[model samples]
Target: MKSNQTYAITLVEYAYGPAFSNAMVYSGYYEMTGTTAVEYVIGVIEGPSGILLVDCGYDPQHEVAGRESRAQNHIKYQHPTKVLKKAGFNPEDVSGILLTHLHWDHADCLECFPNAKIYVQKDELFGWIETLSMPKEYNTLKVSVDICDIKECINALGEDRLVLLDGSVEDLFPGIDITVAPNGHSWAGSLITVNTKDGKYTFTGDTAYVKDNILGGRHDGVSMPNGYNCGSVKNVLITMQDILRLAQGDMNKVLISHDIGVWDCFESITTPEDDLRIAYVAK
Candidate 1:
């Protein structure tokens, strides 16, 4: 018989970024006026063994490539260590990290968690490494590769702290399983599905930017893909459909990492100042 275990998942907002409305939705026509800024978050899974972090939020000083130009007006960043502490977790307490991809914002803070082993899709790591080896100008024009962040991951691998996945769905802890996104937002993004008292929750890292990306379509019951897809748009649509199917059609179970609306669905904790907030804590 299969053992029934449950874990609690929390969404910790560490940074904020601008998102274009027209870019987020799928429409044949383009409207370049309105934009909605969204939050950058990391998922925390608390289980029987220990705490597992989905993605490490970017370090405030990493100088996110294109973001620098608009940094003054569009970006608001916080160090992951401080953010995790505010959420009641110490950086060193994280037992493992389930990286969706090797993007700078998601993987740059790996060094903060000294005791945790990092988990990533094998293809994602190799593809990123190969891209990094290309001529700087060519790779910069073709891809959003962050050499510094990639080097940090490489150092972790050298230290025997990296765990590579062969693109298979497997249990990371008692009630948490990691599933591969058909074609990643980047190369090979991964999703974390956790069984909680409420239901099954899948942390979709950039695969689906917002809830609408998975539910919005031309037809009433169809699903759509996000505007930004580095891999394949076709794969984005297929991945959205798969996530909905895995959630058994319950949209609430599909937790989107960058959706600000997520705060409304969960019980959130925030200070009176309202500048910081932690969403979805088990009561």
Candidate 2:
């Protein structure tokens, strides 16, 4: 079946920072010569149904902590709402948020889009709660989990704004399908595939850090697992393999959330001040 519906998929870079470390971008397979950085982006699918954000960017406070903890050397944080406005969108115009998982960087902005319903994996919500309930030591080691973000998700749930998924895959909207990552980079991580006029575009939210994780590590001919797998290394590898199959060997169709190189892969627009950049893949 051919989809008459089309979407202009845009990647908005709301924040960026020096890579967690040289190893983060290069993976351990390659030598850490120096530090590199990665951009944190939120994917936008604009279609007849309105704007559907794949992941909402984080709050600015987290960027401060991120730098203090050495999680990143520098951070340039911008409110997703403002960033969206610069992209010609209003926060109230958003229809839904397809959250990959509840990591702080991806879900902290939940309150920013007040009118949008959140689409997330049921397992991811419960799994994160389970993690939060774990011993302080264990939870503290998982830097990706932010208590404030968890609270925000709980608030959304309480407000009955979450459309939780129990299954592995679901047709979210016209020409859009979201598949839960097999094991997931985190608990129940998700990959969103959009059928645009250009072709199927897959947004692998942290499931595959960069092309190297799917194509094979940069220097070595082996696939490397993501650094922060609140799940398991084995699960990450399995998920990576699944992502490859879903892409059907079309590299351009797979978009990794944190990869800075994404800016180069699609048609992009930069704001007049050059503070924000949006890359699009569409007809």
Candidate 3:
């Protein structure tokens, strides 16, 4: 098993269109991939590292309010086993889990890989507490985000692998880095980068609802299409500062968790080294 083997990722799922409706005015958010599939990337890092998973999508068994809730749209999952099986992997075979942020969609499913180390932004675990009691004007969910999953992450990996690093620094890994681009999008949002062939791949987890938000370098504001607290221009700007650091252009590729246009950009082929990265399609 070569750790330096070509790293790969897959768009396990992609959702498009307006979501989190209540967030529209405040967030200035238009495109919402709310009820969408959870994207997972199966990477075969350097020698025998087995595999690393970033942002495990929602579990099929977990059910919430239907798409009508605006918060919960047409959420769908391709079954974790199916996604991993595509790469000849099983949950137990995974080595690590790096959750960009624990919004219900991203971190709730950690139990899937009970055997892997869970890495996250140290500040993000309780990042939402500050605004948990704020008024609706903040677009706050006030749903009392469950920390049980995070605790599970700590226990599974012995609290050692439950890593919390600077979201503004790099070198988290040989070809990896994360920046805490806080837009109050969902808790302490983060921007992830995976260095690839020539440049790096940017994973903007819900920090922005769509690709244009980061690509164009503009905060579309906070959107709560889900009846939660819609975001504000000021907070979104703070998030912008973090995302811009990652850069999403000639030098990088932007992966929006819910953008259908962004998702379609990648091929559907399955494998540990899935086709999810900066591409040079002819203009």
TM-score of each candidate? 0.89, 0.90, 0.68
Residue range with the least summed lDDT across 10 consecutive positions in model 1 = 24-33
Q: Give one digit per residue, the lDDT tens place, for model 3 in 1-283.
A: 2122234554443222233342342243443332323233323232234567767655434432122223444433345556566545677877777777776556666777767788776666655555544677754364424444555666755746676655566646655666775545555556767665545667776665554454442343332222232244566556655565566433226665655564356544423343333222111
Q: Write the per-residue lDDT of candidate 1 for residues 1-283, one digit (tens) a residue.
A: 3336888888888777666465544432233456656777888888885888988877646666445425424355567788789889998899989998777667878889988888998888877777667685755422445667677777888999888888756566667777787554777888778888887888788876667667664346555565545677778777777788778888888888777888898899774443667897453
Off by over 4 Å in 3: 1-6, 14-50, 63-76, 128-140, 157-159, 215-232, 241-245, 270-283
Candidate 3, after superposition: displacement of residue 201 in Å?
Answer: 0.7
Clash tally, candidates in order? 0, 0, 30
Residues forming the 10-long window of minimal summed lDDT in candidate 3: 274-283
Candidate 1 runs further than 4 Å off: 1-3, 18-21, 24-32, 65-72, 136-143, 217-222, 281-283
lDDT of 2 by residue, 1-283 (tens): 6455778888888777765565655446554556556778888888887889998977756653354434464455668888888887899989899998888778878888888889888888888888878886785545777777777777878888888887565456878887887445788888888888787888888876677777765535477765666677777777777677778878888998878778888888877674668887774
Q: What is the lDDT of every predicted structure here?
A: 0.73, 0.76, 0.52
> Cα deviation of 193 in candidate 3 (Å)?
0.9
lDDT of 1: 0.73
What is the Å distance of residue 42 in model 1 from its true position? 1.3
